[model samples]
Target: MKRVVFAVPGSLDTPTGGYAYDRRIVAELRQLGWDVECLNVGEGFPSPDKATQSAARSLLLKVPDGQPIVVDGLALGVLPDVAGEVASRHPLLGLVHHPLALEWGLSAERADALHRSEQAALALAREVVVTSPATAKLVASDYGVPAERITVARPGSDPAPRSSGSRNEVPHLLSVGAVVPRKGFEVLVAALATLVELPWRLTIVGDLTRDPNEAARLQASISQHKLTGRIAALGAVPSKRLAGLYDEADLFVLASHFEGYGMAYAEALSHGLPVIGTTAGAIPDTVPQEAGLLVAPGDAGELAGALRRVIADAELRRRLSDAASAAARTLPTWQQSAAIFATALEKLA
Candidate 1:
């Protein structure tokens, strides 16, 4: 059997999108009869302490010489030493969900540092894989990677289960994403504040990160607006429970400033829920116009208008829900994603 090693910064338990991507890819590849090995290089990564670096070096030394390897670009971009160790001896492919430098909320200095590290990692890989065409262009134009050397392979969503009458009692607007500035939760809250008289609720799901200042600011805004009762924060829900949330929600909204590929939007569509997303990053690629609505980023008024329109018009909501279900069915499955990835690896090998 062909052997493949996937090097990632965190395990499946990590809640970030990049970690989710690595977990899905590795599982899918294993189902395809490939011998897959997962190596977790710890949390601090690319900037590991001296002891962590020593451990990572030892881990890399154990990878079978000349075997094909796939590196999570988000993790590898921070750890050039790991990339250097594997590139010369193996067929190394970098799977980049999105360039770390492009993430929102970073200071200029941090963004530049991430950009430099990403470029260096890309330079070391024999092939690069991105999730969307937009990302492909970013890699080619910004990172100087040749277009031909990069492959666009999208992530897949789980099939919507048979409805078990799991819908919610009240009309609810749901947003699923980490509590970070880039997610634009503040915008969603601002939008919700506009419809204070309406009989509806808004739920924001996902764990709050280490940034206390952002969390405090959001909490203060909610308190200031007196939206405490109408809005609920349910952090880090399990996968099974999340599906129930999607089913119960009347509309799934993502007001993110940017996304490489909007996984939550796709998942919402899979559950036959209409989506409201910003026209940033690859959101336009995933959320079709007929499936839901799109507004400018950080435009709270427009977002509120869109939300109201979707909530008030039952016929429009039904139409969008049907369209979203159809669109979701067209998305590639994880098995298909694995096949595409395997083909790319074979060609590079």
Candidate 2:
């Protein structure tokens, strides 16, 4: 039997995009009869430190000597030397959720270092899998990876039922993601401030991370904008409950600074909610124009206007709702993503 190892940062319980991708892919591969193993390299394994490098090297040694290994980009990009060490002995693949170089909040010097590291890591992979065409292009242009060697596999959403309630009430807008700078919660708050008199309520569903400074900054901004009454931040709800939230919401909004695949946007559409997102990263590809609106990132006025238009015009909302539902049906499931990934591995085997 052929074995495949998926190396990633943190455990399956980690609430980040990379962990979600790893969990889904591993489950799918097992169903397809591939011998799959998952190794958690803990948090911050990719830092530029001797201890982190040693830990990464140790992780490379644990993979079965001859098995093809799929290293998560979070772990792989930080430790390019480890990829160099393993590629010679194993058919190595790199699964990138998004390039580290394009991550939000990085300084120019840090971003350049991440870019160089990712470029070196790509050289060591026999194949690379990315979640969107936008990311695939970034991998090619920035990391120097050939376009042919990269595979675009989108993430999937579980089926969600449409909310059953009276439609005559005021519209409720939903935004789901971590309370980090990259997720652009501040942008959403700023947009909400402009439409204070509108009869709409905004619910933010995401957990605040361990970073106190970010949490404090966002809280201060919320107060400064006087959005306390209109906006509510409900940190991390269970998956089962999220469906209900989606059902009740008239629209879904994601003002991310950047995203590799924007899974939440897809999830919202699956629940038949129209979307509003920034034209950053892969959001434009994920959201069909007919299903929702896309605006420039950090443009509070544009986001505010879009929100107002959708709220005031019932016909426009109905049209977008129908279109979003149709688009959601066309998305692949985790099983399909696994099948595509398995086919890629079979060729290399």
Candidate 3:
């Protein structure tokens, strides 16, 4: 049987878009009749300390020689040395969501350091798998990876019932993602603060505990803007509850600074919800122009204007909602993405 070891950085069940993509794709790979073994390579990725680095390095070296190993970029990008050793002994494939250096809020020195290491690690991999064509192009142009060696396997969207939408006079807005600095939750808060005059409410769904500092800052923003009553932050909701929230919402919004593929945007379209997002990372690709209004990242004025336009104009919201459902039909399935991953593995083998 075809076999490979899938080394992920954290628990498969982590409540985030990247982890969700990892979890779904791994399951789909198993269903495709491949002997795919999953390994939790620890959580200290992209910035592992000495102990974590040593432990992860030792664990990977124990894999049988010549075995195919696909390492998630979270861990792989920071472990250039370990990746080099593994690539020499086995088929190494790097699954990159995005380059580590482009993440928001990084100092110049740290970003450059990550850039050098990731470039080295990606070079050692026999093949690379990315979540979006945009990411593939970025890797090739910036990291010096050959475009031909990279495969774009975007996250799949399961068929979901069209949102029933809100029954209240006030429009409901939903923004789903982990509470990290990269998500631009504070920007969203600031935008919403200006829209207090509009009849709209926001419900944020994400893991607040992931970044305590960001979470605390977000709360401060909420209180400072007097949005404590207008916006509800529900931390890391269950799938069923999240689905229900989506079903109840009229519009979906997230002011992310950057995204590898913006899986949440795709999921929102699948629910037939109009989107309010910033033009960052792969979001413009994930969210079609017809499906929603997009603003410049970190521009609260533009974001507020976009939110106001959608919230006040019921006809505009209806038009975008219709377009969202059409976009959802174009999304790939998890099985299809796994087939792409399997094909990449086969070609390298």
Candidate 4:
């Protein structure tokens, strides 16, 4: 049996797009007969404390010589020394969702440090696998990784029954993602505030615990807009309940500042919900013009204008809904993504 070690920073169960991709890909690989060993290096990665750094260093150094290993880029990107040691003795593949340095809301110094460390770590890998072509290109151009050495395996979406959609006279808007600065929920709130005269409600489903300060500010924004009753921020919910939300929602919206793959937008398409997203990152790549309307990342006026147009015109909404469903039908499956991952690993081995 082919064997490989998959090293990641945090719990496999963390509720976010990147972690979910890791978990699903790992499970699918095992189902296809790979003996995949999961190693959970302690958290606080990309900015680890001394204890976390020591533990992660010790674990990577102990991997058997000549073994093939895949390192989650979140952890591998920051540990240049450990990655260098591992690469000298074993084949290493770096799985990158996005460059940590490109993430929104970071101190300039911190971003620069991450960019340097990640480049050093990625340079040690035999090859790199990214979740989107945009990321692959970014890694090549910005990180100095060779274009030929990077492979793009887009995130997969499962088949879902078309959403029944909202029956209410007022449309219900749904947004799914972590409530952090990168998500641009503050922008979403501001945009929605402008359209308050319209009949609609918003439900934000995401992890509020990831950034307490950001959450506090978002709460204040909601309060300032006096949208306390119309907008609800429900922290992360189970998959089943999320599916229910998708089914009940009339429109799916997320004003993310950036995305490596924009998995949520694809998932919304699978549910046959028209999407409203920003043009930043891979969003334009994933959300087609026919399937949804996209505005500039932080442009509140544009977002509000787009919302008003979509909500006022039922015929346009229906057309977009059909386009979204057609787009979803063409999305790659989890099994296919796993096969890609397996093939990439085999080439390295």
Best by lDDT: 3
- Tens digit of lDDT per residue, candidate 1, span 1-349? 9788887775567776656777888889889988998887666754567777677667766887898888887677776666787888888899888788877788999999989988988888898988888888889999988988898888877899522322444568888888878889899889989888676788888777634677777788889899999888777789888778776778888799888887888888888888898998888889899998999988999999998888777688788888998999998898888788888788667
Off by over 4 Å in 2: 45-49, 165-168
Clashing pairs in 1: 46-78, 46-79
Supply the TM-score for candidate 4: 0.99
Instruction: Pick out the ten consecutive residues of candidate 4 with the lowest summed lDDT.
Output: 41-50
Q: Which candidate model has the greater lDDT, 1 or 4?
A: 4
Candidate numbers sorted by TM-score from highest down: 3, 4, 2, 1
- The worst-scoring run of ten residues by lDDT in candidate 1 lies at 161-170
Candidate 4 scores a C-alpha RMSD against the true structure in Å of 0.8
What TM-score, over all chains together, does every model reach?
Answer: 0.93, 0.96, 0.99, 0.99
Clashing residue pairs in candidate 2 are: none
> After superposition, which runs of candidate 3 have C-alpha atoms over 4 Å from their true positions?
none
Write down the lDDT of every candidate, Cα atoms only.
0.81, 0.83, 0.93, 0.92
